[model samples]
Target chain A: MAYTISADGLRKRYGDVQAVDGVSFDVEEGEFFGILGPNGAGKTTALEIIEGLREADEGTVSVLGLPPWPRNSKLLPRIGVQLQASSFFERLTAREQLQTFASLYGVPARRADAMLEAVGLTAKAGERVEKLSGGQAQRLSIACALVHDPELVFLDEPTAALDPQARRNLWDVLREINTEGRTIVLTTHYMDEAESLCDRVAIMDAGRILRMGPPATLVRGLDSPARISVPSGVLPLDDARALPGAGEAADDGVSLVIETRDPSAVVAAMAARNALTGVQIHGATLEDVFLELTGREYRA
Target chain B: MSTWQSFRSLGRAMFLGFVRDKGALFFTILFPMMFLVIFGGVFGHQSTSKVEVVEIGAAPLIDQAVARDADLRKTLKVTRYETRAAALKKVEKGDADAAVEQRGGTLDVHYSAADQVKAGTAQGLLGSIVESANQAKSGVAPTYRLAAQQVEDDSLKAIQFFTPSLLGWALASAGVFGASQTLVSWRTKGILRRLRLSPAPIATVFAARVVVSVGVALVQLALFLAVAQLPFFGLKLQGSWWMAVPAVVAGVLAFLGIGMLIGAWAKSQETAQSVTQLVVLPMAFLGGSFFPLDASPGWMRTLSYIFPLRYLNEAMLNVMGRGLGPMSALPQIGVLLGVAVVASLLAMRLFRWDSA
Candidate 1:
């Protein structure tokens, strides 16, 4: 398979900090790839190097079979980039902002209106960009990136600081863009965002990828126990602990929690006892994998 | 994408932004216009008031002239003093415009040099009075006669000087403040980074910005000329006044370069604003925008040459006010362009795409 992006041992440093230390990754065509990390995990730095916005101290990056550094004009027209901070020309309306980008890319003016509609910003098209809500402006920026219909797009923390509802709305927009068979590379600190959107994710910390794999596969690899819980009054704490396949049990006043490798077995035992009321089963997720890999709570 | 398309699109967007900004509109166009109205009202069509002359001793010539010419009596308000020292002290203290005494075959006129305009007017009136007296005493038909003529139309008023000087001031401030503020804000706001990621060349983006700035400056020049030409202001455009166009372009380019330099170096909008003010305010004052450099002290006149606005003011004044030929603007244009080139080189060297 032809890879859309190939980066090898990319390294960058700023003063005393090693911003990107021996980072390496490859993205397949049409894949929704993500670089997940905390605020200072060097995701933005590495993305910038690949986007040709900054130079790496070492290693190489190739996008669309061309070097991104030195600002390859050929690659520029083939790829889109949405920076972490959404910036528009001063005092421009939402539609005008997209039109300006479209024009810069030599796209037709009509594409601006279409893109605005696609982003569900047609109603706010006449309003100045400054007047747009944070989510609306974020949507406008995505439309700007996709206005020219490039085959590949990069979004740097596109959903940071957004309300939950807006985040979900933007997720739909992003998924639609990816559904159109465009390769997407995103950098985000949100674990659920990476788990849901990315085909594969690289979890980074202190400027190095600690692990890289599919979210489900990574979670499965952790081999962590699942927790099954029921309302406190559903069963006594001692009775929950004695249940079949229940490795450990505790009552935290609200619920009786049982840690077990076989969650189904514990649920069956609870059902046999008519104690399955409000039962909730928690499986291992990417968050758990992050905690296992870093040996600390996930801060973001 | 073609550079032309990028330039056109970006230029249109920037122009829209500029026009929509009421603060920029007021500062760039109306602010200088206010100065023009104020200066023009005070100085335009100004005629010298009666001169207070102190007569020292034995000035029978002046008495006879005043008695003979009714205009002289009205023009010169003569006060007599017992001693020449007292008369000279009156002139020195500005209580009298001039002190005059008869010195065998010649008349001595002592005028304070503080007010060049008023002193020059008094000296001219007295010299003419002496000339008429000499002519009357000779009583012979003069073989030759001296006739005085104005180089420019008599309609030229003080508005002519204020228009060009104030226009130059306006253009300089607008170009510098506009460029610097735009650059710094764009950088801090991440707009520069956005443009860099676009397919449009960075050079094309800046070219578009420069085109819009120059276009706005031209509009400012046109508005200033039109307003000054109104009957109330009485500004008469000279034969080569069109030369101010090229001068204005050069001046804007120079100021833009300085602004870019500040923008590239400053890390924040506040810093850029303060620095631009530091550069522009001094340039306006030292550039003879508020007053004529001819009346300035020798040191100040020399200092004015260091400012680019001085060249712009001088160049526009040459063609628009003094009615000098277009060639007179060439040297100033050359200096402005040279400054533009040098400052641009430095700005390029200092240019940063991001505030970080």
Candidate 2:
């Protein structure tokens, strides 16, 4: 296992609050790793520690085979970061902003325009950053982070304040960035984005990673494998329990839900009787796994 | 990229950003001009009124002729005196505005040193009347002569003495307030934090800001000197005008260091604005930007020395207004350079990329 970033026993304290407490993880080369947590879960703090934006009270962290602490001069040029709610120079167009950042690494100006096109901001290259919509600005922010063409990129809630469509649009951009073989470590609380984008995730809460694995593996580890629902009017609640592989039957107003390990068979039976008008079989999700593992909701 | 190359790129970007900002541009170019128009219109030109003269002999003949004319009589009030000593006494005691004695065809004028401009005006008016009377008597070109004296230093005019200080005030506002607000906003907006994430040296970033401020201050000085050059003010650069260049640069950098300190201390925009106003207004007052601090209380004069604006103002006045050479301006320039060095070092020590 070749890892691009590895950390152990990281701890950071802000006044009396323990921001990143005894956390550790390793992200392999070219892997899209994610830290999934609600706000204030210390994910940002942990990510900042790795990015060298902050110091850990007690920890040993390495990035690209070198320590990231004390701000390694060699390490900095090899990584990119898009901080949460980032801001740019006032009235500076998106292209110029990227050029300025590129200059920091000695990258050519042409890369700035190219990076703009990469982020789907080609038409907006001349528009001032303040005029950009939230999604566009976020995309530009990511473009700035990647302008130097670093191998590892960190995005902290890249789609935090966007509409669902905009969020989806930004998700495609992130996936495209990863497709270019760059290792990306992003922090997000949205489970669907995590499941779709991240190769592996560390579900965090209260400064700790409770579970670390692929999304489906973690979800499948939940006690209930699937939940099947059909309208109660199709067949009264008591009769649905008699269906095969139905673990527990419950009526949830207008529908009867049956927990089942074999939803395919359950779904087929409902369809045979012309009772499949609204039959819905949902596999366990990361949210369910999070709730089952942490004994708390995924949001604050 | 090399550090210098990075610095140039960043500096160019910063300069563009500052100039393109309409509010910043307006304040940089227009705010100081406002003070100039207001103050210059009021104090640029001067004129004098009627004078009461004690004539020793009363035989200039033109005095009698002038007495016959309503306008001339209204302007010069001449009275006869028995003796020169008595007239001189009256003038000394401030009873008479001036005493005139015509001897060997050259009028010896004794004006009470109450006000130099008033005394000078009286002498010129009396001499002109004497010449007119003589010309009427001889049908020849009249002579211009009068012995004028004042026991005090009144060598400065209203316009020349205050304009340089006003220029310094403008630079201070543009450099100090401007830089402080910029640093605060960047920190509050996460711009500084984002820059920290990059490999760019912190000094390189701040160097760009410092360079831009110095450039703005220089432009401000040029604009003021041009305005000061108009015939209305009739200003002469008493010393090498080039001395003001170093003075303006050093002064702006010194105040920029102060601005950095303010930015370091102020955690938010409101706090920065309040602190900037508090520092700038009082410094302008005590540093003699508006009026001479010599008339201010003694302690205030002593306390004003603690602020860099005072040295900057005095330095500008020394070079451009006082027209003193670079060596003569050394004391003020030394203070400014010292401030630039020490304050900048302290500010660098205290400056932070984030409130956290």
Candidate 3:
């Protein structure tokens, strides 16, 4: 398969701090790839290096088979970038802002209106960007990026600081863009957003990637125990512990919980005892994998 | 993406932004036009007032001339003093505009320098009186005579000078302030990074900005000329006045370069604003925008040479105010273009895409 982006041993430093340390990754065509990390994890730095906004201290990056550094013009027309901070031309209306960007890429003016409609900002198209709410402004910025219809798109925390509804709405927009078979590389701190949207994710921290894989594959590799729980009083703590295949059991006020390698055996034992009322089975997720790998709570 | 398309789009957007900004409109166009109105009203149709002269020790020549010529009598209000020292002291104390005494064939005239206009009138009146007296004594027509005439139009008023000088001031402020503020704000706001990521060439982006700024400056020049030409102000455009167009373009480019240098160096809007003010205000005062440089002290006139606005004002005044030929503006244009190239190169060295 032809890779859309290939980065090798990327390293960047800012004074005393190593912003990106020996990071490497490859993205295939039409892939929705993500770099997931907390606020200080150097995800933005790594993304910037790949986007040609900054030079790396050490490493090589190729997008669409072309080097990005020193601003390769050929690659610019083929890729879209949405920065963490959304900035527009002064006092321009939403449509005008998109149209200006479109003109820069030699795209027709009609694409601006079409892109605005696609982003569901047609109603507010005539309003100045400053007047738009955060979500609307974010949408306008994304539309500007996509106005030229580049084959590859880079979004740096496009959904950060947004309300839940807005975030979900933006997720839909992003999914539709990806559905059009364009490769997308995203940097985000939201674990659920990464897990749901990215085909593969690189979990980073302290300027290093801890793991890189499909979310489900990474979670399954963890081999962590599942927790099965029922409403308190449904099963006595002692009986839960004595159940076959249950590694440990406890009653924590609201629920009687059992940790077991085989969730099916635990659930079967609970059902046999007529103690399956309100049973909830918790499986290993990407969050647990992050915790297990980092040996700390996932703050983001 | 063609460079022309990028230039057109960016230029159109910037021009729209400028026109839509009420504060910029007021400062760049209306403010200088207001100065023309105020200065024109004060000095446009001035009539010379009488000068007070102190006669020290028997100036028979002046006494006879004042008695004979009604014009001299109306212009000079003469008073007698006992001693030359007392008359000189009176002039020094500003109580009298001049002190005059006839010493043999030479008439001694001393005028206070505190008010140049009044002193000039007094000196001219007394000198003419002495010359006529010499002719009467000789009792023969003089062989040679000195002819004096103004190089500019006969109807030239203060409006002519104020229009071009004030217009130069407006263009300087607008170019510097506009370029610096735009650059710093764009850096701080991350718009510079956004533009960098676009397919448009960086050169194209700046070229568009330059084009827009020059276009706005031309509009300012036109508005200033139209307003000053109104019969109330009576500004007459003279020989090669059209040459002010090229002068304005060069001047704007020079100011824009300085502004960009400031913008590239300053990390914030406040810093850029204060620096532009520091550079512009002093330059305006020293550049003959507020007053004629000829009336300034020698040191100040020399100091004004360092400012690009001085060259701009001089060039425009040569063509528009003094009615000089187009060739008169060439040297100033060359200096302004040199400044533009040098400052722009330095600005390029300091330019940053992000405030960080």
Candidate 4:
């Protein structure tokens, strides 16, 4: 399959911190690829490196079959990017802001109004950017990114800080863009959002990918004991591990939630030990998988 | 897109954004006007103060005394009127600041209090001269008959001296603060980062700014000249006043470069504004915007030469206020150009698209 973005052995460092350590990934054409990670996972650093906004200390990246760094003059025009917390020129109307970007790309100014319409900001097109609501400004930002109609798009937290309805509305816009056969690569901490919109997701942590696969496949590959919930210190620390099917238990502040294969056998043993007062059994989730792998809870 | 096309599009968009910004609009149009009105009100004409003193029966006697006593000729301007009614009419018409009538060497001073400053000055000088002239009534033998003659000297209005410095400060604040804050704000807002991703050159945006600044300065120059000529200001156009055109352009170039350097070095808009204040406040004070520095301390006058604003203000004054031609203003122009070149180079070296 043809790939839209390909990177290998990407590395970047800031003084003593290794922001992105040897990250490698391939996003195929027309695929909705998502990079899911908790805070400080180096997702944004990697995305910036691929977008050519930043330089990788050691790596090679190709976008649309053209090198991005040292500036592929022709490559920038063919790609779109929406940065996290992206701001715009003050006092410019939403339509005018979009048009400004379009003009820089040498595209028609009319495309700005069209994209505003596409993002359902047509009514607010004439409003100043500073006057727009959070959701409206976010849509305007996306519209500016897509005003040029690039073949590939990159969005870093496209719906971050948006109200639920606004986020849902933006998701529909992203889906429509995908329906047009354009490839997309985005980063988010919301696993459900990734599960719903991404064809394939990469779970990243500490600058490395812990797992990469379809969300369903990744979840199905996990053994039984989908999810376990109990108060901390409910069972003797050593005793819980000695149970029939209990794996390492991780406490996520509120409760000690652990992933295990055989939930019934562990529950029986815990009940006999009188440690089942708050014990509960539920289906496994991406959060459970993350806790089992990374030894840290994922942000809800 | 071709570079030309990119420039046009970006320039047009920036122009639209600049004009639509209410705060910037207020600064561009009303800020200088306010400064002019307030400062002009505080200090009246400083160059040459004109006072019309109508002489009654004392006309020929004062004329003779003025001719003989050179000191009297310098201080008192006695315009002889045939009748006291005619002299009072001139004072009422404001063609004269005060009226004076003399009968048998006892002078009666007639002055309108409408313009208290001018009238007070007239009263002090004429009041003393008339008191001394009446000494002949005090049984003191007259040593000799005194005669007075009037001659117009180099007395230009305070408004004439004030106009240039006010314009300089206006241009400096608008060019420096306006450009620097916007530059820093653009970086903080991610506007520069987004523009960097495009194929267009960022120079187009800055070029538009320079163009707008020069245009605004030129408009202000015309409006100021027209307003200052009104009866309120009573400013006289002396020497090569038109030479201020070049001075204004040079001023914009130098100050715009300084502003760009500040913007490039500042990490945020607030920092940029603070830095601009640091430069603007000092430049205004040293450049004689608030007060005349000609009679200031020697060290202060020497320090003024280091600031580009000083050159801009002095160049404009040489042409419009001081009786000097364009040739005399050459040194100011040369200094401004030198500063512009240096500042532009520094700005280019320090400018950054991403926030530090």
lDDT of 1 by residue, A56-90 (tens): 99999999999998978888989999988888888
Give residue A79's lDDT in candidate 2 (0 to 100).
96
Q: Give me the TM-scores for chain A across all models, comma-separated.
A: 0.97, 0.94, 0.96, 0.81
Report the lDDT tens digits of candidate 3 across residue range A184-293: 99998787898899999999988999999999999999999999988898888888899999998888799888999999988887888888878899998888887777
For model 3, how does the per-residue alpha-carbon lDDT over B1-356 read when each residue is reduced to its tens digit? 77788889998888877887889899998888888899988888763356899999888888888899997776788899989889999999988999988788778889888988888978887888888887988999889887767655554567877888889899999999999999998899888999999989999889999999999999999888898899888888987999999999999999999999999999999999999999999999999899989889999999999999999999999999889899999999999999999999999999999986
The true-versus-predicted C-alpha distance at residue B199 of model 2, in Å, is: 2.0
Error of 4 at A172 (Å): 0.4
DockQ for every model, please: 0.71, 0.59, 0.60, 0.45
Error of 2 at B135 (Å): 14
Off by over 4 Å in 2: A250-253, A297-300, B47-155
lDDT of 2 by residue, B1-356 (tens): 57876788788778878878898887768887888767876776642245778878765554665757787776777788988898888788877788888776677889877767668878787777776766777976646655665422324556666678888888888887777888898898888888777788878988888888998888888888888778876666664768888888889888888888888878998998888889888998889899877678899999999888999888777767666667766788888889878877887788887877
Error of 4 at B258 (Å): 1.5
Between prediction 2 and prediction 3, the one with superior DockQ is: 3
Give residue B336's error in model 2 in angstroms. 1.4
In candidate 4, what are the lDDT values of residues A1-300, reduced to their tens digit? 657999999999988889898898899999999998888889998998898888999989999999888766789889988878666877788888887788888898888878988999999988988899888888888888898889999898988898999999989999999999999998998877888899998888888888988887887776535667888777655676677888877775677776678788888877788888777788766666666666664354
Candidate 3 ranges beyond 4 A from true positions: A231-243, A247-258, A295-300, B47-148
Location of the lowest summed lDDT over 10 successive residues in candidate 2 chain A: A291-300
Model 4 chain B weakest lDDT span, ten residues long: B148-157
Ranking by lDDT: 1, 3, 2, 4
lDDT of 4 by residue, B139-244 (tens): 7877776575433124545777778888888888888976798788888888887877787776777777787778878988888787777777777787588889
Residue pairs with backbone atoms closer than 3 Å in model 1 (clashes) = none
